[model samples]
Target chain A: MPEAFLILILFQLVGSALQTVLHLPVPGPVIGMFLLAAALLWKRSRTRTDKPASSFDSPALSSLSRSLIACLGLLFVPAGVGLVTQMPVLLANGLPIAVALFGSTLLGLMVTAFVMHKATRDRPSPERIPDTGGQVL
Target chain B: MQSLSHTLHQIYARFLPEPNMETLFWLSVTLAVFALGVRLQIRLGRAPWANPVLFAIAFVALGLLITETPYGTYFQSVKIINFLLGPATVALAIPLADSIRLVTRSLPAMTLALLAGSITSVVSGVLLVLLLGGSHDVALSMAPKAVTTPIAIAITTQIGGIPALTAAFAILGGIIAAMIGETTLRRLGITDWRAHGLAAGIAGSGIAAAQVAQRDPVGAAFAALGIGLNGLVTAIIVPLILYFLPG
Candidate 1:
């Protein structure tokens, strides 16, 4: 578990280094997420014939990541508590903030769902999709 | 009585010094409250309003108020948990990698949905704030509220918004979506779990994604993809929009 955590932190550090070097707008951990995903996919491609032996594909890493993400909500408490200091701003603009957040979230959800449904609604099932078989490789 | 009071005060001061004891005390309090919240949420059948994060924050804030502890002190003590967010975020790769096949299968539709959803989330949010007479800072903070909290905070900082305000807005937005997301999607006659989960992830983020995961694994995968992709897209587009439009 510790080793898995170290691997995740190592990816995050590399991502931070990349962000600093390239001045990317995205955060380091996000970059780390993309890098790690890409690396996993790449590893899977190379070891398609047999069970992969790489540590990145280890069940330990998988379980560790799952547990961390399961508790992702608890991770936000500290920052969410920071809202206490913004009470004045929140109180002052409570109406606009509330409406905008609620309305826009609802709208975004609808639009995304609508588009995704429209695009895929008419398509045949997964078995018939041409890209389903070997697109990743 | 006076001597006894003085002796108790001295004992309290000696045993619970300012820095070390305070850290342990606040950390314990935060974890305990959150654990209680998780149990309550489970008991409540994982209702949206009983969201553990929301519960923990409200309780902890009240605790801080009653104890006369500043937000800064509580945050400083629990900063270790916040630090783990980075690694947890990086850990998202595991699920994303696991769902790569599903993602690749519907790449075009997913991309289209992601783009439409991401753009709408930013434009609609910022425009609504401005039109509703909110200040520029408030509008900026609302811009990334649809993204997950960590990425939302980073984007808010980049765009000169209040990160704290953005975090609160993002979490609230998530709760709101989780509350209404399913009914809304169902009313729209969208039965596809993939669409449902993607919508949850894009607009509702982790909070909503967790909700989706409760019902369907396939939808959950798409939801994870939604969170990651929306974060990436919004991170790029919001800055670009600000740069080109200067709003």
Candidate 2:
């Protein structure tokens, strides 16, 4: 578990480094996610025959990941507390901020759902969709 | 009676003394408070608006304010909790990987949905802020309200907004999104799990995703995909919008 955790942190650090070097707009951890996924895919491709399957499926990693996901809500607590500090600003501009936020979110949701439903409404099921590259699911 | 009263006062002073700036003690208190918040949320059947994170923040914030503790001082310990956000976000890859099969099958549609949703979120947020007389800093912060907290903070800072304000708006926007999402989607006749989940994730982030996760894993999977992809899309587009549009 410790080793797997270390690996995750290492990837995040590498991601952070990359973000700093390239000045990418995306967050470090996000880049790390893609890096991890790509690494897993690469490992699967490299040792297709005899590598005792993928290490990403390890129990330790799974458990750590599950725990992290489960307690995900807690991780936002500190920054959420920033609201108290920003209370004055919010109070002064509360009306407009609230209007814009809720309004845009609703608009975004509608546009996304409508566009997605329309675009994929005609596509066949996952099983029937012909595989062109890597495994679909 | 006087001796007993004096003893009680001493005990109260000693036992309930001010929660000093001790790192370990405050750390434990923060975790315990959040754990209690989570338990209450679960007990209340995971009410949409009674979000645990919100409760935790209110509880912690009120405690700090009443105690006259400086936000900066208290953050020394809480920063550890904040740091873990990166690892937790990185851990999101597990679910993203799990859903890759479905994602790859409908790659074009999913990408289109993400782009469309992300663009709408940014354009609408920024435009509304400007139209409603918000400052440029507020506009920059509001632009990333749809993204998750960590990424939203980074984006807001990069675009010269108040990072703390962006953090607050991110959670506020997410909760508000979760509150109105279901009724709005149903009214629009969006019954498909994939479409509904994608909308929730794109607009609401983690809180909305959790709500979807309770009812349908497939929906949750798509929502997770939306969360990650939307984060990436917003990160790219917000800067461009700021540069080109300059609103």
Best by lDDT: 1
Residue-wise C-alpha lDDT for candidate 2, range B59-136, written one tens digit per residue: 888667555567887787678888988887777777787677888878898889899999999999889888888777
lDDT of 2 by residue, A1-137 (tens): 98769867988999999999999988888889778777765665676565576665566766787688777778888777877777887777877798898899889889999998889855432322222221111
By TM-score, how accurate is candidate 1?
0.92
Worst 10 residues of 1 chain B by lDDT: B4-13
Worst 10 residues of 2 chain B by lDDT: B12-21
Which segments of candidate 2 are over 4 A away from where they belong?
A45-51, A122-137, B1-21
Q: After superposition, how far is residue A129 of candidate 2 from its true place, in Å?
A: 25
Q: Candidate 1: which docking quality band? A: acceptable
Q: Write the per-residue lDDT of candidate 1 for residues B55-172, one digit (tens) a residue.
A: 8889988777656577998898999999988998898888888888988889999999999999999999988888888989999999889998988998899889998899899899
lDDT agreement with native, every candidate: 0.86, 0.79
How does chain A of candidate 2 score by TM-score against the true chain A?
A: 0.80
